[model samples]
Target chain A: MSLEERFNEIVREYSERVYWHVRRFVNCHEDADDLVQEVFLKIWRALPSFREESGLYTWVYRIATNEALNYLRREKLRSALHFGSVDEEMLRRIDNDPYFNGDAAERALSKAVVRLPEKQRQVFILRYYDEMPYEEMAKVLDTSVGALKASYHIAQEKVRAFLSKVD
Target chain B: MVRKNDISTPQGYFDELKGRLGDIPHRDRRGVRIFAPWMAIAASMLLAVLIGNFILRKTAAPVEEDNGWDYISYLAQSLDPDGLPDEEFLTDVEQ
Candidate 1:
């Protein structure tokens, strides 16, 4: 297939998946939408030199995940500078999120997920929300499966405890 | 089972999204285009001005003003040493 066709196919295949991935981190529909576009824009730009060293799906996830992580860090720094707690700020965004259609329990679960440390958040979200296998996640995260499992286990415990109390 | 996602987009967002992404030209991936001819012209003009300034400095004599060192030397040469006040006499008058 021509390059444009290939790029379009990628967008068609991964956009929703990438969108939800970003949405989990950002907690705001608008921010997630913007970030999803940014992730694809980055992939499109870097498409030429994509050496195919990893699977295309893994590569796309890596780009989307990195965008989400970077966006989170920027938001955290901004929130901290503005005299707000990052967790509170993110939860506020989630509270105001128009696209979220979850029940109270799901909302509580999402809050619990957001409260995890950044790397653990990634591990938890990918494993629990996307149902991504650790082997595939390792390719996207550039982490060993063992480390991912440990992080997810810790994250899972934290979420479970938070849910038990809240839900 | 992983819970169903809470987030939802407007219907057919993915369809419109692909089209929007396609509109973005691949040139964006490449660095911005620098105007090479304009840069070359600017470099040449700068070089020309520098060379012209250097040549002017080398070829043109510096303009002398009143009370300049050359003028003072000329004035001292024109004077008779005998007609000038002695250093000892001048020092004594100052005291």
Candidate 2:
């Protein structure tokens, strides 16, 4: 198959999955839409250089995760520059998002997830939302499985604490 | 822990997104990371030049308002320089 054909197949397979992955990270459909485009563009560019060191799914998801994390980092910096809180801004977006159909409990859960530190947030999302295996996540995140477990533990506790207060 | 997705997109969003994304290899064959910045810079420079030209033209003195040199420059540009008056004649005229 031609490289373009392979790329198209990859896009058809992963675009929606990656879109949801990034959408959950940003909690805003507009930003998620833009980021998904960027993610696919990156994938297309890097497709030629793929070394096959990791499974294709793992590799594709790693790119998506990294792009989402970088986006959040930029948002945090932007909020800091404007003297606003990134967590609050994200919570606001989630609350106001037209695409978000979550119930009150789900909304609260999402806000709690957003409040976690970046690494913890990513870990929680991958585990809770994505149901991704630790081994696969480790490859995607380049973190040890033990560390991911610990991070997820800490993240779960934080979420539970936040939910308790809300309830 | 319950795991369920609470987010939703408009109908046919993914199909549309996939169509847009599938063209990346053809549309952005050169890679966005490279071309986007350079395109932005080139665009900015072009805009700046255009704006600068516009402003300069707007603020510039009109060509009809000769500062006493246009006549001399015009004379110098004549193909038949021999027919034009010499430095002594111009100095006499200026005085």
Candidate 3:
């Protein structure tokens, strides 16, 4: 197959998965859309020499994770400089968005997840929402299976604690 | 007392979350622009290999130079003495 054909096929297969990965980090659809596109763009450019040393899905996940983390970091800095606080108001607007399907409890859970340190949040999302196995997650995260399992357990505890407080 | 209405939040919350996520525009392939640096590096490597092969093939022909007998004798001496040519005596050859 031609390079472009292979590239297009990959984009078709993984775009939504990439979007959800970014959305779990950003918790906003529009931002997730933008970040997912950026992830694919990076993948396309890097694909020519992407030695198939790892599964293609894992490679894409790695790119999505990095892009999401960088987006969050940049957003945090931008908000800190421009608005003095991360814009809770804007996030609340997203909460009020008609398309948001999560109930109050789910939203509360999501907010708690968002409050987590970046790595912990990523661990939680990949384990819970994506339903990924610890081994596969280790490949994408470049962490050992033991470490990922520990991180997921800790993240679960944090989420449970936060939710129990709301209860 | 399990009540149907006992759920804390409004009934539509999950539906809304799912709808929002679902409504997110699928990223179009045409929208993504590949990074340029990777292509540039690949192109340069290809060009270098091609140029290197061309230069190597061009220079493949052996060249001969005129050197005194002593130089030849030294080269011969570097070989095993048993294999030395009888045509030249090592000592007689001018340094």
Candidate 4:
């Protein structure tokens, strides 16, 4: 297949995956949608130089993670500069959002996941929700497999403890 | 007896999420396509200008003196020997 065909296939396959991955990081659907497009646009621009050293999924995941993290950091800085107040009611509304698929326990788990450090949150989401293998995760994160495994383990333990406390 | 809770979400939860996150707007895509090439060209030109400026600056830089002795000699010879650089010479050699 030609490169454009391959690229289109990738977009069709992973656009939703990328959307959900980003949505988990930022709770807002609108923001997630924006970042998803940005991520794919970046992927399209970067595809010319993409050597197939890593799997395509890993490359896409890497782009999604970077876009999400950078978006969070930028929002954090903007909030800090603007002295924005946390919308606790809005957050509660998000918890009760009709589109959220989780049960009560799962919702609580997601809330706790949001509270985690950025790296831990990324590790947890990729491992649990994405069900990605450690090898692929390591390629996406550019970390050693051992480190990714350790990170996932620690994140799992943290989530368990947080959920247990919530219960 | 264990109780089974078959809690099914509303029929369209996932579908709602999908709809809310539809494709990027067509106008935005048009803007991207139109401006993307120009952006690339502008970036390349800017890079070229920066590189040319750097090369010019490097080539136009003043040459350094090889040693302090050559500079010192130039300074000493330019000044009058009688007015400076040797009271002893003036006393002995008759200024």
**What TM-score does each of the candidates earn?**
0.74, 0.74, 0.62, 0.63
Cα lDDT for residue A26, model 1?
Answer: 84
Clashes of 3: 11
DockQ for all candidate structures vs. native: 0.35, 0.35, 0.02, 0.03
Mark the regions of model 3 whose C-alpha exceeds 4 Å error after superposition. Answer: A87-94, B1-95
Cα lDDT tens digits, model 3, A96-137, are 655467678877877778767788988998888788889999
lDDT of 3 by residue, B9-87 (tens): 2355434433333332233332333446677899999999999999998889966656678787778786766656655
lDDT tens per residue, model 2, B13-85: 8878888887777678555577789989999999999999999999999777668797777777664567565
lDDT, candidates in the order shown: 0.83, 0.87, 0.72, 0.72
Error of 1 at B82 (Å): 25
Query: Which residue pairs in candidate 4 have backbone atoms (N, alpha carbon, C) closer than 3 angstroms, thus clashing?
Result: none
TM-score of chain B of each: 0.37, 0.35, 0.30, 0.36
Residues A85-165, model 2: lDDT tens digits: 988999999889887787999999999999999899999999988889999999999989999999999999999999999
Candidate 2 Cα lDDT to native: 0.87
TM-score of 2: 0.74
Tens digit of lDDT per residue, candidate 1, span B13-90? 778777776655554533344466677999999999999999999999977656688767756755856644555235
Please write out the lDDT profile of model 4 over residues B1-95, one tens digit for every residue. 11112112345544554443333333345666998899899999999999999999888968875989977876777585654556535554485
Clash pairs, model 1 backbone: none
Off by over 4 Å in 1: B1-4, B26-95
User: Which residue runs of candidate 4 sit more than 4 Å off their true CA positions?
Assistant: A84-93, B1-95
